[model samples]
Target: MTSPLSGIRVLEIGDRIATAYCGKLLRDAGADVVMVEPPAGHRLRRYRPAGVPPSAGDSPFFSFLSGGKRSISSPTVPPELVDSADIVILGSTPAEAADLGLDVDEIACRTSVITVSNFGWSGPWIDVPATEFTLQAWCGSTGSRGEPERPPIAVGGDLGEFIAGSYAAFFALAAHRGGGPFDMSVLEAMTTSMQVFSWLRKELMLLEVLGRSTEVPSVERAKDGYVGISMATGQQWQDFCAMVECPDLADVPELRFQVGRWEQRDLIRARTADFFATHTVAEIVELAALFRIPMTAIGNGETLSSMDHFIERESFLSHPSGFRAPRAPWRMSATPPLPPALPPALGDTDSPWTPRESRAERTGLPLDGVRIVDLTAFWAGPTATHLLGMLGADVVKIESVQRPDGMRFAGGFREDVERWWEYSWVFHGVNSGKRSITLDLGSEEGRALFGRMVAEADVVVENFTPRVMENFGLSYDELRGFNEQIIEVRMPGFGLDGPWRDRVGFAMTMEQLAGLAWLTGYPDGLPTAPRGACDPLAGVHAAFLTLAALEHRRRTGQGQLVELPMIDVVLNASALQVIERDVAGVLLTRRGNRGHEFAVQNVYACAGDDQWIAVSVRDNDDWHALKAVLRQPVWAHDLIYAEDTADLIDGHLADWCKDQPRDETVSAFLAAGIPAAPVVQPPDVIDNAALQARGFFQTLDHPLCGPLPYPRPPVTGHFVNSAAPLLGQDNAQILGSSLGLTAQDLARLEDDKVIGSWPLGL
Candidate 1:
């Protein structure tokens, strides 16, 4: 099948995995991408897996990323290729990009330039070097990781770069469709992908939206392995209690609410934890499925290859070298995605394409003038539309009065207030800048009215299980009937056609099933994750495919269906872990605060209460510099020159850090040229000095929630001044005024239970 980007030509001159992955996505979509590698080749080519053969030329990880792309070993980009290229991706600082002859101003107006860097284009630290850990630390989302008392740890497997690469692909296609060149900060991308904007801004502390835990017994031990469970609503909680056969908790009114359950967690855990410990993983999995609960066993890299779902879904592709690699994270109808293939060797396919005229840039935000019908409820679906809305798309969020977006009551429930749902900062943060209108699909009038809205919309996005849309008679076929060029994007937990498609899975399920959770946490402990990463991972990926579909429609006047499975995205993000089992003949587990690239990486306690700092001695230079700063004794230095001094140095470093303030210590590390950052608390994340100076958070005013700081779009410059709409706030404005419905017609419909601003019974 021909891809949406089959005819496009792309030139990739990037350094980070983010850029390579972006180009790889373009290539996977059938674009002709020519990778310009340094004479020594990309760093990934030499990135050997732990305990694996150290043959630099046969890197399985590099092949996983660069697969199916043509590679040329060249000192510089071919001039003719620049003009012929539809896009040029550069993963470097502005100065370095200029040195590589990829200066934005110097490039032709037609060739879209995409730049992804550790900091960003104009930031003070843009030119400074940064490791993956440094970027993860700066993003603020890592604040919620690890035990609350322990120093925060970076999520393993370079998740920040994985997210950045996903967002870069989204922006790349946006730029191709006259959205203009973009400079994306990997830090912002990581934060955004983790839904820090929705969580940190509202002070939910972290991503508790969708189905991961904030105030629940989320991670628990099974007889053989660990499992993650999430119950976002009261029904789910009661169901959980029933499944555990906890008579005291089952059908209990107080336990129905999260806050009440949290307050009585000791009692709940006593009953639940015992049940978990006594059951095997298989027994628990079966029980959870029988109860239709959103739970799954936590599988690590080694276990993932053995999953029944993995085999049934054909999640891996066997390479020519007899190793396996993950397939694409998403799929689409009309134009299916290409399978993973071995990457080209150096100097292979060095041939250049003929010169072509560049397309002109469009004005305003990337998605300007596009209208989206958003039917998403929780984090993943709302997040995708949230990003599109930020890009200037007119997003109309469709919810029903009987059952609005579950996120409205996600964080809390104030029984005293009549309009308590309107005050949810979590809902406001995720749904910002989108219009809301109520319509009961169960009613004929509501369905008819929705069909009209669909006719005027360019895209319809939903996170419902595959059957919900078809049950509503508003599937892709129905949407296409309303508007032949309407892009239908589905965010399913498993996928549209997988054997587990109908199973109730959430981000927690994905994190465990995809092997990411297995790679997190301390080496000796059970797997945990950077809470609900699969939400935004799938969110941004959905947006990327939606953009691709839009571009395809622009060219061929046809809109198709795109399926973004939350688990697949989690699996793909854990690709770095996936390759290890294939190459090293062993699975890599969590290493706590330890790092792979650096000589010494760990966290140390500071003087203040629960305060800490993370420092990495990249090499001997940083180690020597740290010792000089600490004024270590001559005897200590005489003990060793370069033979396993990391642990010894770390012990001494811990003593020195205990007496110093965290921020002060961080400054000292930075001054001494060491990679370091504070493990920021949730409140401190909002007040991060660097983020404040960069204007990362801009204030947006909501009627009920008042003025609040909203994080800017990951790639866009800043946020629009609009706010998340009150439930059904746009009904009168849209139905009566815009959709040509008479006032009398609206009133009659409201009286007939066809529409409402609040839940009918409430």
Candidate 2:
């Protein structure tokens, strides 16, 4: 199959991983991406990934990032390449861009320009340096990590930059039609995960906002290694209880819901641990499979490299020295992404640039005329469609009157409240900017009406387990009969045909399977499960592929089926760790609040309750600046650069911060241009001065929820400027006007329970 982006061209100018990863994504999608590296080499060449052996030369991390892209040895970008590019990715701050001899505004006039950086374009910290640890700390997710008495932990690897890079690709394609300059911030992309959900939940219900106290996703000691498990919904918990032979836990009234179960986590943890300890990993897997529990064995790098599922699916690819990586997170039927080639050597040559037909001048949004029929629920799929809606696609969400989105009743059913289905803040938060309409897909009349809508729809999206689509008789082939030009996006937990395709998997299960859980937490071998970032990662991956499919349709007048398995999303995010082990004999383990890239990164206790501040000394300059801030000079300046001195600096920062208040300590560090932030709580996120200054929040007025502010995802565009619709808010307009159904026809459908505004049997 031909690559979807076969004719598009991209010029990537930056040494940062965010830039390199952006180029890689475009290249993977089949764009001709030319990477500009300095004559000596990119800065990434100076270091190798952690745990990589000495024989792994020239940065295996860089090689994985620059895969499939031709590299030119140059101090400055070639003017011809920039002029002929459809997209130019500038992964630097304004000051650095000036040093690169690139004009952002001038180049944006001809092609789309996406600037990816750690901070914002016009901010006090714009030119300041940042690390993954510091960015995660500033985003507030790190604030809630680890023990309350000890320092918080950073999710290992350059995962933050990878996320920013992925967002950059989405921004690039999203702005293709609309020629413009766009800015993507690494911190902003992370905030859309733990931080946004943390604060948004507090704003809605004032519940347990962050994962500070309770741990729903906890790791237990299996006979061989460990297993990570979570019960996201009530049903999963019941099945888990039954499978473990603790049927008593299932019958407890308080344990019926996830929120309630969280209150008694210690008791539940003890019971599950006892069960897990008695069983081997294989035995636990058998039990989980028997009862369809959402759990998985916590695999390490070596285990991940040889998983039967991965081997069967051909999920991994490698270069020389056994340096490993996963394939692209998506697959298309007609125009599958080309398998990426190994990283190019410095000064490698490719064919001369030939620009394809330029897109028409976009009047407003890039996806102004596009229409999407959304059939997704829960976190990942809703995240994808919500982002698409923000890019100006007219997204019409479909839910059955009798069987609506499961998210509509997140806290479980309530007998007292009359309209319990409309009370989920999670549904409102994730599904914003789309019109909702109810229809019973179980009925024949409703299926026929859905077929008619498919005939006029540009794309159809869903996230059911594999059999649901086939059972509904609405697979891509079936939808093609309605409209041959329709693009269908499927987000299964696993791919369509894998042996594990039908396995009951959720966000946490995929995380365990990806082995990222093995690399998180403190220096201890036990896993500190992440806050289910995989789901949102899946969402971002899905949205990117949908646009690629749309571009394919624009080029070949062909619509294809695309798959974004959640497993692939997490694996791709955690790819570096797996590759590190592949290239080395040792496994990459966790170190709390510190990384191999930094000399000093720690969270110090402050004056208030649970108050703390994150500190990262990036390099020699930062180390000196930190010393100057503290008015403490080291007698041996020459020896200060050594790794042993990092321990001293960490101790010094802790002592200095322990006596002072968090605000004052953070202020001192920031004024000195050091990367430091207060470990902000969930409630404080709503009024964060930095996000407020960036205008990151938009107010959407809802009849029931009032005019509340919602954090916009990290992208520059005209998002849908409305709140989430009521269950079937647009039923009348869509059915009566668009479908040419008479008032009597609509009344009859509503009476027959085929269509309605609210739940049928509520």
Best by TM-score: 2
TM-score of 2: 0.94
Measured against the true structure, the TM-scores of the candidates, in listed sequence, are 0.93, 0.94
Worst 10 residues of 2 by lDDT: 48-57
Please count the clashing residue pairs in each candidate, in the order shown.
0, 0
Cα lDDT tens digits, model 1, 302-399, are 77766777788887778665577677877888777777787888878656687786476477777888999999987889889988888889999999
Residues 113-158 of candidate 2 have per-residue lDDT tens digits of 8888877675556765567776777777777666554566666666
Q: Candidate 2: misplaced stretches above 4 Å?
A: 51-56, 207-211, 349-360, 411-418, 633-638, 760-762
RMSD of each: 3.0, 2.4
In candidate 2, the residue pairs with backbone N, CA or C atoms under 3 Å apart (3 or more residues apart, or in different chains) clash, namely none
lDDT score, candidate 1, position 708: 72
Clashing pairs in 1: none
